[model samples]
Target: MARRGKTAAKSNPSRSDCSSTSNSLSRRPSSGDVKTDLLQALSAIAAQHVNAGSIPLAAALQADLKDVLRRWKQEHASDLQKNDKYVYPLEGRYDAGESSIENVARSSRDPRIDISLEVGNLSGADEAVVRALQSICNELGFAIFLASVERARKTLDEEVLDEAVRLVRVFLLDGGRVAEHVVLSPSEILGLQHLLPRKLIIYEWAAAISALEGQGQEEVPAELSAWIELQLLELFGQVPKLYVEDGPALATVLTPRRLKDIVSVMEKFAGTTPALISFLLAIHSKEMPISEETRQAAFKAVFATMLASFDITQDPKDVRMKANEQPYRPRSLDPPPKPPRIPCLDSDSLVQLTMHVIEDDTLRHELSLFTSQLGAQTTRINPLDFESLFLPFLHSLALKTTITEPHHEDLRTLFATTITAYHDRFVGPTPPIPPSEPDVADGSRRWVRPPVRCTCAANCAPLNAFLADARRHRIEFAVGRQRRAHLHQMLDATPRTECTHRTLRGGSPEALVVTKIDWDAVHKRNVRAAWEGRLKSFGGWMEKLVGAGVDLRAVLGLEEYERVVERREEEAPEEGAKDGRAVAAAAGELRKRKASEALVRSSRLQNAEGAGRDVRRRVAETVAVVDLTDD
Candidate 1:
């Protein structure tokens, strides 16, 4: 687990507890006291350090003392300088040996005011040096330095103030090497919030909460615990903004485990911050477009966090009680019955062939028997039959078509001669040159020729015509070769259904694991919903802007509308012109039609009394027309 720093208490300090003083600084300074009282407070702190035998701290304090005296000199100017009693000479401010007890009371005649004069000289020097001085001062006594810093905060730049706040955290929260316990109160830590980095503050809150929780049921400081809880609640307010502006970048910095911890802490103290809820909605609502990896990681992080919340351990009731358990009893068992095994004939020809090749007599006999049975049940054909029968018939048809359809004589002759020559050269002799002695009485022994042999039957002429035309085309030849090879492969291949063995018995159990969730679908849905919501929100804002008289074109770009017009013209200028003309024509036609209707209405009214029944009927029809128009 990553360690987060503890937060300071959120409680406000009471006016009475804000300050305390020594005899040298006897009066509790009011807000109106300003510079003089602040200087006096510093002097008192220095005196106190010197009395406590912390020589190093006293020396560092002396440096601060001189800074106050010098500033006072500048502020007082000639009034103090001219009054010898009021002013310590300029040279005395630099030299601590000559110093401030001459004007003010001291516990010793020569208090060994061993101060690092260099620190006073380097007050306006390098920032690193200044910070080092602050850290040293913080270690000596946080109270005095914190008091001095609080008083001087207005005069300090952010750099110095940031350094001061960090020192306070280190000293107060970490308690340094010398401190036995936390040296600063939660209120003091909280007061430093103005100067502390927000990033540091949030982490400190997390760390403090973790520590409080680490103690389990033990008593904890109420103020500290409250501070941690408050910080956690407050931190959630920024989490959504952080994720939205730079979720991927932020994800790189934070581990899934760390995110889960943060989420867990938020849930424990503050049900859920609105910003965090919005962030989760954005992550889960597939409408928000994020990278697949990022979405998956976010999902995994949520899943892991939620899974961690479940107490998967066995329940107390579910656990068997050893005290009430029955003892195991040894018993004699009957001999196990053997399961009958039926022989499963292997379908692979290679296995059988290998057995025969190795001169296994039993396997060879079984293979011979299997082959004879298979041959008896199945019909077989020969490749040589196509060469002897089909090719000659197709060639003859092509030749016949060339003679009958003389328009394509050259092309048909070219196809028929090419096929005939190809068959004669590669496929040997044509029909009547039988593979074996053909029976004279029965032609069944000979190769079957087309008409009856063709699968297309009466449409064999069309088939021949197509084949004749296709044979001359280059693509057709390539296609035909491919299809022929495919057909051969299909015929030669063993069917899977034939491999099933109903005679076989016995089986082995198998386990299959499948997930119920479709993560891809979930991620897509989230992204889509988030995007749609965003679009709707944007659309509403856009509508408001347009309603307020903001021109979209001007807002988007000065020439946006012009560019759109130009693009439209470029794509289909003629189409646009035609549409415009059509609209104008339609408008003119509608106007003419409306004028005619008005004329008819006026004529009907004028003739209503003169034409009696016919005019009244026409007027009534006109009234019906008016009613329809009104509707």
Candidate 2:
């Protein structure tokens, strides 16, 4: 029996009471009871290991723990039901690493960390044993927190040093995606503290020089500095890029080649970021050794970045903030709206449409992006060359009849902002193409675009509608284009000897022709009058046509053109002037009527005198009475 007792004790290591020799002799230990005892013993051991700073034990305890708890609850049903103080301190044989009984008891009050203490009886654990277990797990959690901090510090130090150059390169070269995925903590950046300040100093010095030089000419706007500052803050997350050697020391000697490279890099990378350009401008200006051309290029880049970023529709407050050098509010994370669908269209077609689809706010936003890109390209280009650079595009768009909203006047603003009419500097291979001949095929003569067609009648009403709209838009666009062309001619026209007198030269021959009379506005008042008259006639004609069910736009023919011109001519007054014609006609009619009346009276009197005998015979009495009254 004593030997059996020793075997049972060995088999159930969890049980504190192993020397039950008499009880073992009385009845063999039940396998179920032994299993329960073993589980409780294992829990007690795990609880001690946790107290000794073992974090892994917590995870192990958590697995299959539910079953263990059920079994434990079954054995301690009475103690749990009674809610008695069943937990008691263990004897003086407690592990030296374990928390003191008092500490364990105190920690048992917390429901989270004291999970075993509060509910251990359900897991077949004594309350005192669970409390002791929990106290040690708390220590392990603290050790984990400390270990994480140390690991992070070591990792950060290594990463910052290793990635410092790459970070700077990525920040300047690919700022759009530089911050994705990777996040470096402030401390991590600080670890490479020795390497950050020189770049920052360079940036600051550049900014200062630009501010000083740019102030007088408005050459360097505040936006450049703001942009640079914002970009720096975003990319590096802190200033002082890798340490500086105090004062205005140049990072490197600004040799012409280096200056050129820097300018190129800035131009390529700046995009719409004005601040970067400003910083480069500052550097260029301060580096007096560089050629004037280099400085000019830097200036152009800065100007380009600023103008490309400009959005007239932006809130004034935002503009003011940028102007004042404030950080921009972070962009919202809302997904961008899906682009509008226009079938049978490509990007070039859309770009063309952008010149005409002015009223649609959504379309306007998309167009802004295109124009922004165009603006960047036009940075050094002259506005006088806008005809060569932009007219061909406008002409292509104007011929597309499917985009019918009347041209919004704001499109002019876009043109004016991007291209400068002050100089004729930019020259490219492409010359301006007339709207009438927008396309060429097989390197042959210029060709007109054919009327657009929808794929099918039943399935493409939207397409047809868009085409119709586009056509209408093209009409207004045509008018606007003509106006702008005239304006451009006026702008670019030089004093020329015409008949030996100085005169502004007329534009291309095509400029004199306008399909819509409204587009020819050199004599604006007369043209407007003609347009108003034409519109009135058109309204009446259109009503008649619609009533007659005439398909006016169904087939393109000379009849439509003839009808429109004839209607307009019939509506036009014979007099070139409208308002003054009525007054002049009324005066002339009054004079003619007066002259006719006087002549009629003279003829009647002469006839009466010549036929005096007949008159006397017919009205002798009346005539005598009239003579007596007169006497």
Candidate 3:
């Protein structure tokens, strides 16, 4: 009842005969046969759509995409195995930066650096905070590269590490968290780069602790630790930049203020903890010879105190930390090789320890900042005054046994570039209740700072007055002025004409000669001394120049006065010899020049004054009279 189809079983097969086939069977199509006819019709329709830049896909076709690929994979699995390559990559979402074929057939199976990282758990985070920390770490990386390593090395010693950790913890507890990435403040960072090492060390420590305590060990970031450290110092040249050779994280979270706080905390331990102190001492490549017993006792004391801090248990939510891990306590297990004369401390010797703080390069740097702020007025607090100002502070610091309190020497020494005998003492208010007296419940006689008085007044009068004057201008000027005043006294009161010059003297004008009997014989013998009659003034030498006018400055050597005269001369030049304007100008110039000459003469007398002040300055001015009589 069925008819044969035209589809050939073999090439060039003939068509089926329609005459022998039943009419009903031929007209009605079977399901399998109808599918072929349907497919051919759909293919033609699809071709039309394709030409029109449209694609039609059935639900089954779309859903079966993976399955279709699976089939293809199965068919090509042997070829794929032989080639050791991806025949093609599945495509939908990918960068087309490099000419994009659907797939990158080449296989680069080597390790990769993942710059793109998944930003998880930052949903609730303030983006600003994260960005800030990231930025800081990057900046600091350059400036503090060496310092970080040095700090880490110091931490290798358990005693130092414990102390250092404790300090960081305290700062964090008190006022430690930084808002975001930032550079160190100018006040701290401008003076010395020393803070870098300490900052770097703490950052590395924090980072290390985080890795251990769970900041994350998920994947090493695009930034390799070593590379980041190197970049921190080397790249950016005095600035900080992050080098992420391999990492998955977006940040290296350290900040300027945070680093400063951490450094301060560490510095606290630097004073008390043997570990920190010794490590610092060692950095100087010097030695402090201490007996075994003394060192042992001191270190043991530190250790015991540390243990007490450690005994307190942690919260249930926190991990069980190691003994030296706490930030509050510092431990010391080793004692000195030799025992000291006493057990633990000698107060006098301890007092001298304050000097080290004052001498510390880092502390000095901080102090330098104060001077910078004080500006030109820095001299107001001279070495002596500065030392005096900070004396009480230093004394108090000297009394402290712990590093918690700030050191006076470090702070005060900033102003004192050089201390001498002048600064050996400083005066302040004395308390009404001495240490020997009992405490006053009513607070009678409160102590107040007395006004600073001039020390020169204690012994010398002129020096005292000079000091008062010195408070206005430069001290050197004041001293010079006093010297000049003294010179005037020596020269003016001690008349030159009455005294013998012993050196260049030919003056007896103040003495009046009673008689001269040898005048007759002398005149007759010298009658021909002047054969030709000559006329001469009794005592006259031309004050004016041979041709032009005399220069006031050239004669007096008073530069300022010369300038004044020169300015006048230029502003009002002489016109004619008889002109009234010229006459007035000449007279004015003469008066000014005469005044300048007097000042010059007084100044020249400075050496004769010596240490005499009143004798030189109290005298009246000298007058020179020229004789106009003819002989």
Candidate 4:
């Protein structure tokens, strides 16, 4: 009976044992339990590998560890949300000699990993490791910020945007490393277009584009290049405002090389002319101190793109007519013809752009860039166009006396060439006008009457006509008091003219009697004198431009030199001869006055000696008186 009872007890479990088995089967593993199991499994795997450097085994182990970590994070997501202070279990092992945190930090895009752990665990990190971790943090922070910006599309959260901007500023200011980790999509850039700081955009986008250095345009996706160009255009529009806001900070990021990079990127896409122009103008602004090399590069890119739209060798008039012609309408069944390529620059824009290029002191010196761009097509540039554009630029050069000596020779050459071109094209084979003597009446001593310049409709025209006739010397205008006063004022302004107002006894308007007095001789003399003064002034100006002793003929060209300088020189002698008698008479008068002054001095000397004798005699008498008194 005892044996049977013991068998039953062994076969049928106790109530407590049954309850323990059911609980063990039904209960889930806690986070602590899973973590302990994961650690034990990882330890066992590590212990089994005698060769710790076995690549296959290490790879398998890493794969398993990643899978386990991923599942654990997913399963324990609720727990993770509850605990904000949870640290990654493998955080310490990341920077261990056995593992490289740099690779993981660089390759990982998982936002679930607490990046703050890597950021805070920099106590004994190597410099490279620290930079890698910092780069990772920056990338992650930027990603989060971008997410917020994306979310902002639906709901405009000012707080989120502000915080995002602050975080982005930190990432951007950290270094260029962040750019390597995160590539901004077109949509991302477009989304943050208005929101992102321009300096930050410039730095990151510029760096990203620069990273694709060796890749060909074909290798780069067209959409990306297009967006990049659009982005650049948008940025260029904000240049003035951004420059004001960022000041010198903008310059540090959008450097000359960066500008070249941007231009190169734009060149890949079609119809980049307007944006390129804006870019050119932006860099050319007083704010941006772009280097000459970069400026030229930008100019080359812009002009090349601009010129591609039209045949520069064609006549501008023809081009204008063609451009203004109505578009060709197609039949309903006809395939749509290719759209006409619109010229990037019109005549006015081209002229204005050329003026700007010419205005830049540095750029003007290197006009080979301008000429080289025009290439052989320069012959087709209309003379009218030339006059409209280069003539004004040449005239401006005359006013630009502040040009330094280093640029003088180049400018002098440009000045000479332009003047020659203008003379040959516009002035046309006409002989240089010799200096003319003032017109004089055939038998009269008085000169030809000069024209009155007054424009008043009342009495000035008749008076001017009368004065203009060389034969007529005097004219009387019977007019009112006010009319006579106006006549007198006009006569006063006119050279070598006289006017008198006479009141009639019968209450008539005063007679304004106008007459010429030595008009021709006085006018000619004054004209020659003015020419001499202008010659001297112009000679001095030329010297200032090309340095002292530079030949005016060489700088001003043969025609201009002879017309301006030689003619003045030839007329100078005649002017001197006309003044010679007046000069001689003045010298003679000076000599006569000197002789009279000498005679007066001699007479005064004699008188002084006689006075000296009388004074001596008085002194002797006084001395004798004084001696007698003292005794």
Query: How many steric clashes between backbone atoms does each model show?
Result: 14, 28, 32, 1
Report the C-alpha lDDT of model 1 over 177-248, residue by residue, as the tens digit: 222122222223322233222452333333334333332334547855565456545665554322111222
TM-score order, best first, reads 4, 1, 2, 3
- Return the TM-score for candidate 3, rounded to 2 decimals: 0.15
Candidate 3 lDDT score relative to the true structure: 0.25
Q: TM-scores of all models?
A: 0.18, 0.17, 0.15, 0.26
121-161, model 2: which lDDT tens digit per residue? Answer: 22212232333333332332211000001011101111111
What order do candidates take by lDDT, descending?
Answer: 4, 2, 1, 3
Give a tens-digit lDDT track for model 3, residues 461-480.
43334323312211121233
User: Candidate 4 on 1-631: residue-level lDDT in tens?
Assistant: 0000000000000000000111112222324544443343344343333323222223343333334334444554656442111111111222223324653464366533323222233222122222222333333221211111111110111111111111111111111123112212222221223333334333333323322211121244666556546665665454321111121222323445356544444454323343344445545555444676775776666566555542343433232323444566766897777753444234444445556766666665345545444433334445444445554444455554432256455556655655445444443332222234433445453434665678677889888777666666667788887887787777778775543334444546547666555544566656545444433433333334333223345466444653543331221123323567876776677668756865874686567643223333332332343232222
Best by TM-score: 4
**Candidate 4 regions off by >4 Å?**
1-412, 420-543, 546-550, 556-560, 568-631
Best by lDDT: 4
Residue 278 Cα positional deviation in candidate 1, in Å, after optimal superposition: 19
Q: In model 3, how large is the Cα lDDT of residue 89?
A: 7
Over 4 Å off, model 3: 1-159, 162-229, 234-282, 285-421, 424-631
